[model samples]
Every structure is written in C-alpha cells, then in structure tokens.
Target: MKIAICCRKGSFSDYWLTYCEENGISYKKVDAYQSDIMKQIEDCDAFMWHFSHLDYKDKVFAKQLLYSIEASGKPVFPNFKTVWHFDDKLGQKYLFESIKAPLVTSYAFYTKQEALLWANKASFPKVFKLRGGAGSTNVKLVDTRKEAVSLISRAFSRGFSAYDPLASLKDRWRDYRSGKCPFFVLLKSFFRLFIVSSAIKLLPLEKGYVYFQDFIPNNDTDTRIVVIGDKIIGERRGVRNGDFRASGSHILLPDASKVDMRCVQLAYNVSQKLGLQIGVFDFVHDKDNPLLVEVSYGTDPDYTECEGYWNEKLQFTSAPINLPKMIIESFIQNSSN
Candidate 1:
C-alpha cells in the first residue's frame, strides 16, 4: 500500500517523512495546493498535511481540499469531525452544546441590535473572543455592560481585525518575563508589530456576530488534554498575571495529576464519541467542576512537560510515546483492517 503526504518545509511533516522512511513505508510527497492535486493523489491511498492557521492561502482552502479527498474515499488525519471546528470557536460552541459537553456558558449574536440587547441584560466580566485564534491572542475580558456595549458597537461597525499588534507585544513581554522566550523574541515581536497584518486578519472583521463566555473567576490555569487514538497527553497552562485566559500562558507540563480527572474524562469521552483521530481540548474549572473552553486538532508538544501518557483504558505508562508515528500507523492499520 502507498501513502501520499502533503509536504511542508517544517512541522509534523518532518517527523512523518522520517518515520515513513525508517519504517520502509512507501510514500510520495505531494503538494495539495496545485491545480492537479486531485490527479496527483490518484496513486496514493492516504494524504496527510499539517495545514496551519496562520497561512493566508492555507486558510482559504486547506479544509476544503482535505474534505474533498475524504469524499473521494481516501483517509485523512482531520477527516471532517476532527477539523471542521479547528479554528472556529463559534462552530465549536454549537458542536459542544449539541454533544451535551460541559462547555462554559457562551452566547453568540449575529446582529448588533441583538448583541446590544443581550449586553443590557447580561452580567459583567464576560470573556470576549474572536471565532479563530490560539494562545488567548484575540481573547478579551468585557467587565461591564458598558464595555460589552462598546465592543458590540465596534464589532458591528468596521469590525475588529483578527490581528492585534499591541496585544502581540504584551504577549511577547509576558513570555519574556516568564522566561519562556528570550530578548530577541521580544525584538521579533516588536518588528512584527509594524511589518504587516497577520494572516488571521485575512479573515476580516468578526462583525454581525459577537460571542462571549461567562468568565470563570479565579481561574489561574487552564488544563489542556490531548488525545490521539488511545494515548493521552495533558498539561496545565498558568494564566498571565491577573488574566483569565490560559491557553497562551507560556507554561506547560505533562503532569496528569495536576489535571482534573473530570476534565480528562470529558475530553476522552467526547473525542472518542466523535471518532476524532486527535483532539487538544482546553478547560478551566469552578470549584471542582471542570468546564471546557475550546477544542483543537493541534498543539506544540516540543515544550510540553508531559511526564507520561494515559491509554484508552485509563492506564498510565512511563514510556515516551510517539504521536506522529501513532498518527501514521493508525492510517495504515485502519486501512488494512
């Protein structure tokens, strides 16, 4: 059997190529962007691509291509359910609720008047977020009815750009202070502040609709649990000073004990039910109740401090696990069976 991989210079593809080569797995590197991508993949049984959220061209059609390939009967890593909500929190709001998952109370409005009306009656300190973004980059805290109203006006007016240079600078500073990044990283972030808009802005303003979540107070950290097949790796990201968002706290560890078992149970159950090959779920809690924040298909494992992993049966092991290899092998095994 042969497989085709959508090759990029860096990213998971690097590990994929190395694994396939070492295992004597027959594979070809194919570009999923070209006009003849369909014909190009005709010779392979599966395709894999670590499509990114920061690429303009990729944002435009990566999922479309992946879906098309799946529709054509070839397997893909992010087959529909796994990816349809990749960068879209709005879509996820509906999905989580539909699945009866314990998502933080959230509201979405498609009109300014509706948003304003809700703002009048809604409580303060709601967490405002754009539909797409990671690391708490676009997440904001709306502390009062007035603040919510003002945001509603702006959201419906020229709309808000998905990219915030000033926020980027603050994040860089936070990482530096936390010793997670260096001085040069701050310099790069400063330079990027003036260079140009991020590819995320190609998304346009998130006007016409506003989304807010009930802020869970005193949440100093958020738990991140990643599940691939039966292996699970999890982390806890501490929030920045006085901030409620934890996804980009510049801290991570793989100590499962630090994570609430309830959250892990929710992530594992939901991901398994969805038939997701992989899922990285964010969560925070109130007292002992863990609440889900968001879910994604990817996370940077390089810096994570996972001491071990858990299996589908909830058994823990101290052995170092290989996610990229697991991803590729699953495709092969699923096909043969």
Candidate 2:
C-alpha cells in the first residue's frame, strides 16, 4: 500500500522519506497546506504530517485535517486521540485528570474574576503558562499573588503574544554560552527583537483564559520520555543556568543509567491507553514521585543520541533509537491489518 507524507524540510518527514527510500516503501510527498490536500492523499493507504505548533498555518488546521483523514477509516500516523491535545495545555489538564495520570496539579480559569479569586487563595510560586508553545515559551514562575494577579489581568486584556522576542533572545544567549548553537544563530535571535516573523504576526493573541501548575521545587533537571509504539527513548535535560525551567535548556546529560524507569513506564501506560502512535512526556520530580508536566504527540524526531531504548516491559537494550522508522513501521503494520 502507498503512503502520503507531508514533507517539510528538517521535520520527521525527513527521516520518514529516508526510511521509505532505504526500505523500498511506496510513498508520495503532498503538501497538506494545499486546497486539494485530501484529494492528493486519496490513493495512499495512510497519511503522515509532522505539523508544527509554531507555524500559524499548521496551527490553523493540522488537527482538523488529520482528524478528517483518520475519520475515513484510513490509518494515520497521529489519529484523532493522539493529535487533539497535541499542543493544548488546557485540554491536557482535563485529559490527564480524566485518565488519572500523575499530572502535576494544574488550574485553568476562563474568567478574570475566577482567576483573581483563585490567585488570592492559591499559594505563591505557581507556574503560569499559555495554552500553546513548546520549548518553554510562554511559561513563567509567579512567585507572589501580585504577580499572579498581574498576569491574570493581562491574560484577560490585550493577552500574551505567541512570540516573545526578549525571552527568545535570552534563550539563544544561553544556548550560545553553552555552545549548543553558533554565534550566527544567537545574532539572528538578537535581530528578532526588531523583526517579528509574519507567521507570529498571524497568530491570534492568547487571552480570556489563564493556566497555572503548582511549582515543583528543588528539581535541578527534568526527564523527557518519548514512546513510539512499545519502544521508549528518554533523556535528562538540566535546568537553564539560574532558571527554574528545563525543557528548552539545551543541556543534555546523556546517561542511560540515570533514566528513570518509572517515568518511562508512565509514558508507555498513558500512550497505550490512549492508542497514541507516538507520545512525548515531560516529567519533574516531587521528592521520589515522578509528576508529569505536559505531553505532546510531536517532538524532535532525532533520538539517535539516546544510548538505548526500553521495551514495554521496561527492558533496556543498548542500541541506537530510530523513532521515525518505528513510527512508519507501526503505521504500515496497522494499516495492513
């Protein structure tokens, strides 16, 4: 059977194409943004698109398009359940609660009055977040009720932008200092202060609702577990220098022995229950207990650096991980069935 893939450069589609060509799998490249995207995939047995939340166009209709394709009884890489909550933290709050997962305590309020009332009584040092954004964008630590109230007021007023130039610059500087990126990359970030992209300009302001999660303190690093079918790969990311967040901190501590199996198991269990084709879970620790910060269906596809991967039984094997291959293999197998 043939497969339809939306081939964006540097996306998971890159690996998918490589794997397909190397293994002699029949596939065609189609632009999901086109008006006749559905018709283009009509002959394919399955469709795959690594839609980005940061892109205004993808944000507008990726989920709807994927959901529509899956509804037609054809297997897609990320079906309805996997993608509906892809980048939505508000939806994730309810989803984790409904499934009784070990999600960090989260709160979402639709009204300024309700948010203010809760902020007044809620403890300090809560983590404020917008509904969207990856790599720690739109995330903040509200250390006091006043700070929470200010954020709440702003959320209901002009709202928060999908892009923050200052914060982006700060992050780029950190990466530069840590040698994770080149000077040119850092320079580009500095230039961003004056020139915002048209995509960011097209994005609607995030407003009317404010979300917060109880801050889990004393954790210097966080773990990310990514499950592709029954195979799991993970890594530990150190928090930014003198900062509380870790997701975007390019600090990679590549020690498979340090990988927490509990977090791995939790990621697998949740993914299996939801029938997700792929799942990426970020976790922080509260003492000995691992608490989930958030989850997504799409993340960086490269897992070659991971020393090994764990099986569904939590058995670790020292082998390189190829997440894109696993995803395509699983997709083809299921579609064939």
Candidate 3:
C-alpha cells in the first residue's frame, strides 16, 4: 500500500516525508503540478498533497484533481468534504449555516444594488472579507455605513487586488516591532509595493460579491483549534495591537488551561460530521459563546507550543502533537474502514 505524496516546501509534506521514513511507511513522492500527475499516482494506493490557497496554480486545479482521484476509488488525504471549501469564506457561510453551527452572523451580496441596500441597513463595524485569502490578506473592518458603501462600490467596480501592499507593509512593520521578523525582512516588504508577484498577477481581482460578518466586540484574542481524528490541539492568538484580526498575529498563548473545551468539542463534532481528515477552526466569542469564524483543512503545520491533545471525551494527554503523522494515520485508517 504505497502512498503518493506531493512535497511542497514549507507545507506539511516535509513532516509527512519524515514520518513515513522513520516509521517505514510505504510512500512515493509525486508532483501534483506536473501534467502526468494522475499517471504518476496510478500505482499508489493513496494520494496526499498539501495544496495551498496562496498558490494560484493550486487554487485553480488542486481540488479538481483531488476530487477526481478520490472518485476513482483511491483514498486521498483531504477528500471532497474536507477541501471543497478550503479557502472560500463565502462557501463557509453557507456550509456553517446549513449545519446549524454557531458561525458568526455573515451576509453576502452578489450585485452592487443588493450589496448597497444591505450596507445601508446593516450595523456598523462589520468585518469585511474576500472569499479567498488566509492570514487576513483581503480582510477589512467596515466601521461605518459610508465605508461599507465605498467598499461595495469598489467591489462591483474595479474590484480588489488579491495582494494589498500597504496592508502587507503594516503587517511586516508589526512583526518587526514584535521582534518576530528581522529588520531586513521588514525592508523586503517595501519591494512588494513596487513589484507584484507573478502568481498574484495571474489571480483575477476579487469582485462582484461583498461579504461581511457581524463584528463581535471586546475580544482581544481568538482561539485556533486543530483536530485530526479524535486528537485535538489548540492555541489562543492575541490580536495585533490596535487591530481586530488575530489569525496571523503571531502572538500565541499555548496554555491548555485557557482553552475553552466547548469550542474544542464543537470543532471535533463539526469535523466528524463533515468527514474531514484534518480540520483547523478559528473561533471568537460572541458574549461568551464561541462562534466559528472560519475553517480550513490545511494550516501552518507548526504547533510547537501545543502542550498535547484532547480526546473526544475532552480528556487531555501530555504527548507531543505531530499533526502530519496523525493526519496520514487517520487517512489510512478511514480508507481501510
């Protein structure tokens, strides 16, 4: 039973490779980007690829390819249910609402007139976000109706770039101030202002639709939970100073005592119900009740601060959390079952 693995640098692939090597798991490295990708995986019993939202190529075809492979009766790491909504907030709004999950109140408008009408009546300080983007790339806070209307106008007109140089520069400066990045790294962010990436150039502008979520105030941090099979690990990330977003803040508080078990349980249940091999959910509180913000099948695999994992019964175990290993194991077990 050989597993087909696509190894992308900085993705879960490196850890997957290491785990397979150390445990003597049968595996072969295949490139998903190649034209002969399907043929390369034909001999393998299973396929795994850490397809990313940031990659324009992956955004275009990774889900299509994975779904096709799964339909052929071979197991894949993230099957259809897991990745269909990977980088799509618009999709998540529908999915979470359909499941009756406690998702933050969200609204999406397809046409300029519809969006303007909603914006005029909606409450201020809503969180605006594009359908695709991680680390708060295309996210903004619409503090007033005027701002919302302007955003709606832009969304239906010229649209928005997938990459925002000014916002990115601010993020870089924050990192520099927090000592998370070197001064040289901060300097490189300036280059992005003048030079757009080829991949970003290929990505079409996000337009036509405008999505907003009801802003839950007074929360300085958000909890991020990662669930694979029955094991759960999480961290509370502080929001950037003077900012409302927390996902990419890099300020981690890994104390298990601080984690709300309810969110953990909800995460596990949602993942199980969705038949996800691996799920990463971000949550914020709406007056003490945890409301899911968004979810993804793949995330930055680094969880060095994770003290351990919690079981389905909310039982915590003091063991190192290796997400890639657990994900592959879960995939194999589910496939066999």
For each candidate, the alpha-carbon lDDT, in order, equals: 0.82, 0.90, 0.90
Q: How many backbone clashes does candidate 2 have?
A: 0
Candidate 3 residue pairs in backbone clash: none
Which ranges of candidate 2 are over 4 A from the true structure? none
User: 217-314 in candidate 3: lDDT tens per residue?
Assistant: 98999999999988999889999888898988889999998998999999999998998888899999988899999999878888877899999989
| Clashes (N, CA, C under 3 Å) per candidate | 2, 0, 0
With candidate 3 superimposed using the best TM-score fit, by how many Å does residue 84's alpha carbon deviate from the native?
Answer: 0.1
| True-structure lDDT of candidate 1 | 0.82
Better of 1 and 2 by TM-score: 2
List, residue by residue over 108-221, the lDDT tens digit for candidate 1.
999888888898888788999989888787899888898888888988888877778889898889888878878998998898777875465566666778899999997888
Worst 10 residues of 3 by lDDT: 321-330
The true-versus-predicted C-alpha distance at residue 9 of model 2, in Å, is 0.4
Q: Model 2's lDDT to the true fold?
A: 0.90
TM-score of each: 0.95, 0.98, 0.98
